[model samples]
Target: MTSADVTRPSPGRETPATAAWRPSRVVTVPPAVPPVTTGTLADLVLDWEREDPGAVCFSRRDATGAWRTAGVAEFAARAREVAAGLVAAGVRPGDRVGLVSRTRYEWTVVDAACWFAGAVSVPVYDTSSPEQVAWVLSDSGAVVCVVETAAHAAVLEDVRAQVPALRHSWVIDDGGLDELVAAGRGVGEDALRAARAGSGPGTTATIVYTSGSTGRPKGCVLTHGNFVDLAANAHAVMPDMLDEPGASTLLFIPLAHVLARFVEVLCLSVRIPLAFAPDSRELVADLQSFRPSFVLAVPRVFQKVHAAAGHKAASGGRVRAALFARAEATAVAYSRALDAGGPGARLRAQHAVFDRLVYGKLRATLGGRLTRAVSGGASLGEHLGHFFRGVGLTVFEGWGLTETAAPACVTRPGDLRIGTVGLPLPGTEVGLAEDGEVLVRGIGVFREYLNRPEETAAAFRDGWFRTGDLGSLDEVGNLSITGRAKEIVVTAAGKNVAPAPLEDRLRTHPLISQAVVVGDERPYVACLLTLDEQALAAWGQLHGRPGLDLATAAGDAAVQAELQRAVDSANTSVSRAESIRRFRVLGQDLSLENGCLTPSLKVRRSEVLRVFAADLEALYR
Candidate 1:
C-alpha cells in the first residue's frame, strides 16, 4: 500500500462522521448513554443497596478455600462502616488515602470506602519496591495507608519518615479492616451520608500512577465522572457482554493497574458478579472454581495459555502432539473462514471433531462457562486472536492507557474484528496525526497529571490527548496499533523499523518470554531475547534433556534451531531491510525484579538496550 492508501480506510466503508471528521485521520462514535452530570462513584454501591438489596455483586475465596458471595446491601454497609472509620480517624474530605494490596474483596471495599469518605485513593502495586512506595506516597501526600500484609506494612514503615503526611497505616492480614469497623461504631449515620454527598461527578476519584515503561511514574488524576460515565457508556455499547444474566468475571490482574481498576467499577456499574484471584499461582484453580462467564487480561496472559496448552500436548508424546497441532491449525482456519463468510462443510466437521477432542478441554481449563474474554495492554496479534476464537473463546482486544481511564476503544462482541482493537467507545473520538500518533478525547480521558502542570499541558494538542503510540484505522474504523513512535528504530542505512510487530510475533513462540528488537543506529535489525522459564523446562523435558538451565540452553543446538525457526517465521512479515538479521539469547530473563520490565509487563526498551549493550554489539561483530 502507498502512503496515501495507508492513510485512508477502504474506499467506501468509512464510519459515519460524528465530528468534523476526516475518513481515516479522525473518527468519532456518538455517546450511547447520556453524560453523567451528577453522582459520585460512591453512589454506585449506595443506589444498588437501596434498589436491589439482595443482588449478588461480589464473590470471594475464604481462608478455607471456599467461595463466598456478598450482596449489594452487605457491601454498601461495609463500605459505609469503612468510610466512617476513616472519618473517625481524621481522614477528611478530599484527603488522599493510600491502598497497597493485591486484587481481593477488601481492596474493592476500601476503594469504595475512600470514595464514600469523599477521599482520593492512591493505589500502589503490591509488587512495588520500597522506593516506588515512597515516591507514590510522598508525591500524593497520602494521610493514611491500608496495606494487605505485614511485609507491605514493613515497606510502608521504611518510607514513613519520607512521607510526613502519612500519619497511620493498617495491615489487612492482621484484621486491620475489623479494627477499622470497630473504631467507627460510634460514628453517626448522618456523618457518613454527608461525606458521600460531598463530591460530584467532577471531583477527583483516584490518583493512578502510570506503570512507567520509560521514565518515573506519573500520577494520572482520574475523576469520578471518568469512571461513572465511561462505565455507563461501555455498558450501553456492550450490553450483551456486561448486562446479560449470569454475566460474571474473574479478575487476576493487579487492581493497581488502570485497566483492572476500571474493570472493578465497570462490573459494579453493571451489577455483574466479580471475583478476584490475588495469587497468580492459584489463578487456574480460581478460574475453575469461580467459573466466570467472561474475563479480562493482557495479551501476554492469553499467549501463555496458548503456549502452555501446546507444551502440555507435546509432553504427552509425538502422536498426541501432532493431533493437537492439527487441531490448532484447523481452529485458525475455521475462524478465518468465519470472516470470509462461514466455514465450509468439511471445515465445520473438522472443527466439531476438535471441539469434542481438544477444544473442550482447553475451554475447561479457563472454566467451561468462559465464552468471551477482553484483552488489552498489548496486541493479541491475529494468530492468537483467531486460534482462541476458533477454540470457542472470543478475545476482544482493547486499546488505551492510564490516562484514558482504561479503554478508549474496545472490540465489540458481535461486530468483532481479529487484528484491530475496534472502534472508539461511545462518547469517544480517535484520530491519527500526520506521523500516525494516536490522539484521543473521550469521557474516559483523565483530567491531568498530579502536580505536573507543564507536563500535562504538553500531553494534549488542541483538545485531543496525544497518545504517543502509532496506529491506523481500518475500513470499518477498527484501530490497529502499529508501534510506539518513541520506540521506532532507524537503521544505519536510514530505513525506519517498527519493532513491536516483530517482537509480538516472536513472543507467540512457546520458548520465548520477551523479545527486544534493537538496531537504532546499527547496520541492520537485531534482537535480544529472553526465554520463558516454564515453557523452557517443559520444552527441555520433551527434548530428552531434563533439568535444563537458561545459561546452558542459550547455547544448546536444539534450542538455537527452534528459536531460529521462530525468528525466521517472524521475519516473513517484514521487508528484508526491517527483518531481524541476528539475535542473542540472554542467559537471564528480563523481569520487574531487575527493572527491565514495567509492572504491566511492557519492556523498558532503553533499559534493555543499556543492560544488554554488549550483546547488541556482539550481534554486529
Candidate 2:
C-alpha cells in the first residue's frame, strides 16, 4: 500500500487512444502491484493479527443502536475459532459451504473463517426465494449452510430434500455461531494451521452467483489470487482515496454482490475500518451515528438522495424552493468550471454562499464526514456526478461485471473525468470486439463459471473474456459504456437503436422513476414510463392537485405536459429515427417486488416486455 508498489506502463507501450477526433478500441494498463504468488486470502487475517493486533478493523451496531468496534486480534481469534468448528464438523479442504445473510459483521467473520478452514464459501442473497436457494446450493454442492434468521432457515428447509449434499444448517439469530465455537473447544491449533495451509493463491475462495437479470443465476468460480491481486492493484491505482488520512467506509450494498465483497477484502487489506448497514431502512440513521469517511453504492442511491433534497426544499415554500433551485444551478456551474480551468470570482463567491446554505445541509444528510464515494452497477448521470462534486462530495464511477470480480476501470479523482467510467486499473486490459462488445482480461477476472465447462469455453475468445457490454475508449483511455449488446432494439426499417441512453436521460427527471424504450420490428420508437411516487406527490401538491392517485395523475393534462417536456429533452440526444415518438405512463413503478427489476437494481428487460406487452402494443396503435 505505498507509491513504490505502483508499476507504470512499460516504455514503447502504445497508449489506447490518441486521435483528436474518434475513440480507440483497445486499452491496457500495466500491473500497479505484482500478483500474489503463494499466500491464500486467509493470510491477510493472520498478517493483521501478527502486525497490527490492536488496530480497529470493523464496527457493528449493538442491540440498543449504538456503534461498537472490534480490533484485528479479536476478529482473527473469532475467525480461527469458527474455522476450528468447521474442521471438527467433518469439513475438509475444497468443501463448499453456504452463507445466506444480509450485510453485517458476522458475514465477514464467516467468510474469513471459510477461507481459514480451506473451504469455498458460497454466498446466497438474503432476499432469495426457496427456488433460488435450492438452485445455488444444489449447483455448488454446498455441504453446510449458515442463515441469518429463522425465516431464512424456513426457506432452506422447504427445499432441503432437493439438495442431497447438505448435511447441516445453522441460524445466526439463535446463536448458531456460539454453539459451533463451544463445540470446537477440543480442536487443537495444529489442526487450524494445517487447514489454512492447505489453500494457496490459486485455490478456489468463493462461488458467487450472478443476479439473474436475464436468466437463471450461474455460479462464478473466483480464486484467492483474484481477490488478493485485485485488491493490491486497486489500492495502488487509487491511493489518494484509499490511503487518505482516517479513511473508512460504510458498506450498505448486499455482501452477495461482487463489488461489496471486493470492498470487504480491500478494506481489510488496507486496514480501513469498515461498517455495515444490515437493514437499508435504517441506513440514514446509521450514517448519522457511524459517520464514515467514504461509501460504496449504486447509481440509484445517489438519485434518491438528490430527489429527497429537492422534495424537502419544495416543502419549505415557494421562495425557499426558488432559492434552492438557484443554489443547485450555481453548484453545477461551479463544478463544470473546475474542468475548464477554475471558477470565476463571482461564481466562486456564489458557491461559497451556497456552501453555507444549501451545500452544507446536503453533505450533512449523508453524514457530515462523507467526502468520497465509489458508484457502480449502472451509469451515474453526468449532472448528478457534477452536482455532488460541487457540493463537496466526489464520486468515482467505475464499470465491471460479476465475471471481473468488481471494477476493472474507475475514474481517478485527480484526473476527474465526469462522464466516462474511467481508465483501466493496473494489470487490466480493455478492448472492443468487431461488433463493439467489451472484452476484458486482468487479474480480477474470474477463472470460470462453476460447473459449466462448455459455457466457460464460450465465454473466452483467444485470451480476453467477453463482457456482453458495448463501450468506447476516449483519446486518453477513459471508457464510456454505451449499452448492452443483447438489449439493442431494431425497427422494421432495420435501423438500430440503443435504449440505455434514452432511459438514463429520462430517469434523471424528478417525475420519472423508470423508462423502457421499445420499437423492435416496428415502424417507430416508443416508450413505457413509470412515475416516481415521492416526486409525483410533491409535484401534485405544488400544482393544487394534492392527494392525487397514480391513475388520475396518468391522465392529468398538467402531468402529461411535464413528462412530454422531459421526453422532448431526452430526444435531443439522438437522431430523429432513434428518438422516442410515443409513450404510455404505467400505473405503478417497476421494482424488485414487482419482478420488473433485479436484486442489483437492473431492469429485467425481457420481464418488462412480457408483463407490459399490451401497453407496448397500444403505443404502436
Candidate 3:
C-alpha cells in the first residue's frame, strides 16, 4: 500500500542520465482480471483437494522413465505430512526455509509444504556456487535447507559455518523427505491445519533471488497475494492456453527463476497437471514422453531447438538441406504474412507443403502435442518467434522481471505479435519514464527487496516499479522491449547504442553462442563473440576443416568470414552509428562457473570485459 515518491530521486542511481531521460506517455491496459480473492497458495491447494481429489495434479519420471502421477488428494496429503514434519522440526510461522534442488517432485512437495507450514521458502539455484548459496541462506535468514544431492549438500556444508542462521541441512537423495515425514508421524493433523491457516495474503511466500548478472543477487520478497494475483490474471488472460482440460506444461527451467516459479504455481492453482524434467538435457526426452500441451522455456531453449533442427537437416546432405532451407523460408514468409494480417492463398499453400515435410517433423521432436510455448528471461529473437509460429507452434513471448514476480506483460494467443512481448497482463499498468525506461504497477509486483529498504525505495518511482528496461508500447498496447536502460552505451562521438538488439541478433548466428557489444566511451561499437562449441565443430567439419577446435576455428579465415556475414546481416537492421564495426572472437565460452554469465544465461558485461580486457583492447587498436 506504500508508494515511493516519484517526484524525487533515490540512492543507487546508476547513471546521471537516469534523472535526465524524458518520460514517455503513460500506457495502461484495460483491466481484465476478475477480482482475485484467493487467500494463499496453500488455500488453493486445499481447495483443489476438496474439489477434485482424484484428479491428477503432478507427474514425474521414475528411474525407468515412466511417469508417476500424484492426484490432488495424494499431493495434499503428502504436503500436510511434510508441514507436520516442519512443525515437529521446530520450524515456526514466518520462518525462512531454503530449497536447494533441481526442478523435481520433491522440490514441489517441499515448496508446497513450506506454505502449508506457514514458512517462507527461499530457493537457491541448483547450479549456484557455494558463495551464492551462502549469501542467499544468510541473507534470507533461512534456518533449514533442503538440497537435491550430497554434492548440493556439500556446497551448503562448506558455507554452513558462515551462515549462523542455518541450523539444519537435508539431502533428498539420502532419504531426507522420508526422514521428515517419519519425524512428523507423531504430530496431529490439527497442528498441520493450524500451520496452513496461519498463512495469508500478507505473508511472504518466497524470496526469489535475481540472477545477478550485474551485481550480487538481491532477494525479492513476494507475498502470497503476489502469486495469487499473478496466477489469476495470467489464467484470465490465457485460459485457452493454460486452463483447457488436461492442460499441462513440462517445466525444465530452474524453479529458482521467478518465471518458472510463477508457471509452477499457476499450474497448481488452475488444476493443470504439472510434469517435471530434471534439466534441459533431459527436457527433449521428457517432452517426447509426456507430450505436454504447452511449454514455458527461456529463449535459449527455443534457439537450441531451432539450431538443432537446422544442424540435423543440413547434415542429411545437399538435397535434403536445400529442401529444408526452402521449407524454413516458406515458414518464415507465411508467419510474417499472418502477422501482417492473415496469410494469403499462395502463402497458405506454401505453408501447407512445409507443414507436412519440415514443420511436422520438428513438432514431433517436441512430442507432437505442443501447440504453444512461452518464451521469457530474455528477448526471444523476432525472427525465431516468427519461425516457430510458422511451424505450427506459436511462441507467445512475455516480458517480466524477478521483481514483478513473473509476467508483467505477455502476448495473448489471439493477438499474437511476432516481435512484441504482447500487452500488459490484465490489472497491470505499463508506462515509460522520460528516459524510455519501462514502469509497471500491478498486483504481481513485489513489496520490497528483503532487508534492502533503500534499494527497494530506489526501485520504485511514485507507485510504479522502475523496470530499468527500455521499451515501447504499440498503438494497441503490445510491448516491445528495446534494451536495458543501464546497459546503453554512449560512444565518444556521443551516439547512444542499445546492445541487446545487436547481441540478440548476433547470437542468432549458429556459430555464435554469446555476444557482448561494447564501446561505452570508445570510438565505435565493437563486440566480444564466443563460439558455440558444437556449432563450431559442425561448421568446421562441413567446411572440410575437420578436427578443428574452437580456438583453431576462431582464427580460421573461413570461419571468420562466415561469422562476418552474420554480423553484416545484423548490422542491416540498425544505423551505421549503432552497427558493430569490429569484433573479437574469444576461444572460451562464457559460463556461470566462470562468473561470466548469470545462472539465467545472461552475459555479465562487466565480467566479460574484465576477463577479456586485452582481447577487447586489441579490437580497437
Of the two candidates 2 and 3, the one with more favorable TM-score, higher being better, is 2
Report backbone clashes per prediction.
0, 0, 7
Task: Please give the distance, in angstroms, between residue 581's alpha carbon in candidate 2 and its true position after superposition.
Answer: 0.9
Q: How are the candidates ranked when ordered by lDDT, highest leading?
A: 1, 2, 3
Give RMSD (Å) of candidate 1 vs. truth.
4.1
Which residue pairs in model 2 clash with each other? none
What RMSD, rounded to one decimal, does every model reach?
Answer: 4.1, 4.0, 4.2
lDDT of each: 0.88, 0.87, 0.85
Tens-place lDDT per residue, model 2, 331-446, is 89999999999999999999999999999998888889999998999899788888899999999999999888899899986898988999888878887778788887778888
Q: Which candidate wins on lDDT?
A: 1
lDDT of 1 by residue, 53-152 (tens): 9999898998798999999999988988988889889998899999999999999999999988899999999999999999999999999999999999
In candidate 1, position 359 carries an lDDT of 100
User: Per-residue alpha-carbon lDDT of model 3 for 522-614, expressed as tens digits?
Assistant: 999999998887766666666778777886877799988988999999999899999999988997999887889887877788899999999
